[model samples]
Target: MFQSTAPQRRSIPHGRRRAALWAAVVPLLVAAPIALTGEAQAATPGTSVSYATTCTPGVVPAIHGTTISEITVDNATPKVGDTVNVTYDVTQPASGNPTSTALPANVILPTGVVSLGGAQTGTVTVSGTRTNPPVPGNAPFPAFQMTGSFVVSNPGAITLSPGNYNINSNYIISLDTPCTIDTPPAGVSNTITASPATVPNNRVITDSPSSGPAGTKVAISGSGFTAGATVTVAGFSGTTATSDVTQATADASGNLTATLTVNAAATTGIIAFEGATYTPATASPPVAYSVTAVVPPGGSSQTLNSSVKGGTLSMTQAGSTVTMTPVDFGTGGSSTGALNAITVKDFRGGSSGWSLTASNTNFTGPGGSSLPAAGLSWTPSCTTTAGSPSTCAAGSAGAVGTAGATLASAPAATLTGGQFAAGANLSLTVPAFTAPGSYSSTLTLTLA
Candidate 1:
């Protein structure tokens, strides 16, 4: 019912709060969309409206309002059917009044809402509890202020849950004057828009190998965390290796991975905490872990190597050079030139047998011109192509020893190793008619 004392508006009979506000003396039976009207024409400028604790001065009059404010349920995202407190009001002193003032205000809401006060305005619906403006002058109410909420009612096919709501609190204040009633504005209302609501997702933590031995490396991972956020991974030990922590950062994808090394002394019943931040407001689910004193079969790995030492053999020539003194048949009978002692080393690991051979065995002149094989002999007795013995033959019956062996294509003698040094005595018995015009030969020794 309309009263002369105050112009009160009610929630659309059975509807949801939308972005628009609607008001009518009688319930609007039609569900047609309400044509939006602009801001109310300036109220004479002689009267101003201010919601601040202290009104701003030195300015023209204007109407500023909050068209859309959030309404949540138990701190969660706002859903249809949720209870909420919605407040709104207009402030203007009622000191000067010609006859009376009639300013109609209404709350329009979306279509799908249920529960909470909702009424049928010509079109839209809305929901929210408001702090209504106190009666104009008397009842201890905020001057020219108003507030209230509407119930989201579902009448028939109308849904009070989710939709683009046209919730507006519109008003047109009229002042009656004896001379002439002041011409007021067309429409004054709060217009606002809001993004759709959604539910919050839960966070999660996981690991590669859930259980392992102390000192084993494990990969810790997390998901569904805030983007570009920092989280700490803590290791809580039941006994021995006690407390430890590390931090990881989430990428734009809201995921992160960190590696943790189990303490060698860590015991069972270990836990890891992936905190939202250094000092988090919310505690994520704790990640449980286990550590064993003995490393599991494949937990740790060891590498071994097998090696062997090689053998080396070496031979050193007395001086790496051999020089022969001139031997002349002019004073022929016997001429012996002493050569450097050749040394052989048995280094085949542990004393092995070896042999040595000399090339050209016999001293020869420039072009294949040779010397008598019998004429040259060595101090050691060995076999050769020439007569095995010369003038120094085995004379004694039981003694099998000759003075020396002859040097043919090869030395009538061979050298034995296992000895450091063995002397090479060259004996040359020159024949009386032997022609000699400075004879020289190259002797090469190969050892193995």
Candidate 2:
């Protein structure tokens, strides 16, 4: 048996002395036992003592709370090298009492985003922790606070893209989406975002020949807009009357061309024009379109010698109205006399034809006495030339006789292709017994 010395010194061999030291150290070492999670020692002789002293954290938290309350960003759509502020909310586990870890939340980085420089941490709020279950207690210490910022490396590419990232490294969450955190205490969701985004410089409009008279057809065109969109072209009529005259569908390349009919009565001035998309409609600034009044080509006139050959008459147009000299019959002259020759020249762009007609077949004068229809005659046939054509034989005086009846001139005057000419000859017979001081009759030549 080995004995220990009590304040005693003795001479012994070196090998024996070494054995004695070993014997003493062995009992003390055996007396102190190292437990997996507690301290163990012999306190009083044979009385054993054991209690928890320090905690050894395992690889993971004991009770991992899966709920992530929120994740906020300073700039959701950041350009390359643009610092983005981020914040997260998550409940930390209770410490010392047996719960989870106290690491603050973290914001995951999106692809193509490289951290450059920014505030790496934000103020953190921790839920009160308890070590005594349902009893008053305090949280022992703080776990590592997890916070940081990510900056964009390629700004041009990163902008206008969704923030698709996570709130922590352990979860595959999205900043733009409500993420479901799947940990022990599951069924918790997280959300994140900052600003909205859109593309720019995508539309234009133009019109050809911006100014014109009423009824002019204008061509409207556009490009650089959303493809496959329906565009409506409206012409400004007044402050309130915006008439939409044409509609076009955009092609895949975002181009369109259409024609619009300007109202014949549209007000003259700067006419506003606009092109717009129907779906999620947007409009280009109103462009000015000039409207002008139509100017007359100017009036023309012509005169003709009366059938009396000696007398004459003339025709003229004032504005849109036409006037002609009155036919005159001399007092008691020849038993039979001719009236006059009327002619017409057409210069209308429509190139339409016209006809002439007489209101009555005879003449009436002072005493209400009238001349016989047979006394009145005319050559209805006309031609593009100033004189009658060869086919106008029946047009001779007394040739086309509807005895005692009315006569309407025919063989329409026309602007054949471009222009036309026509003439008319009238004849009358005077009864010797026509009791009158001066004779007069109304002859209306309606030229249309």
lDDT of 2 by residue, 168-219 (tens): 2222322221122232222212212222232233355667767677777888
Residue ranges of candidate 1 with Cα displaced over 4 Å = 1-145, 148-201, 238-244, 267-283, 295-448
Over 4 Å off, model 2: 1-56, 59-84, 89-139, 149-196, 264-281, 297-448
How well does candidate 2 score on lDDT at residue 311? 11
| TM-score for each predicted model, relative to the true structure | 0.26, 0.32
lDDT of 1 by residue, 1-448 (tens): 0001112111211111111211101111111111111000000011122221211111222212222112222111123343222222223321221112332222111111212222222222333332333233212112222223343223322111211222222224322111110222112232212223322334556665756766677687777667777666555432223444567787798887887776745433222223522221222333446664464676885434333322322334344333344445555455545434444333222212233433222233543333432244445322222332211121111100111121211111121113344345554555544455444433333333
lDDT of 1: 0.32
- lDDT of each candidate versus the true structure: 0.32, 0.32
Q: On a 0 to 100 scale, what is the lDDT of residue 225 in model 1?
A: 65
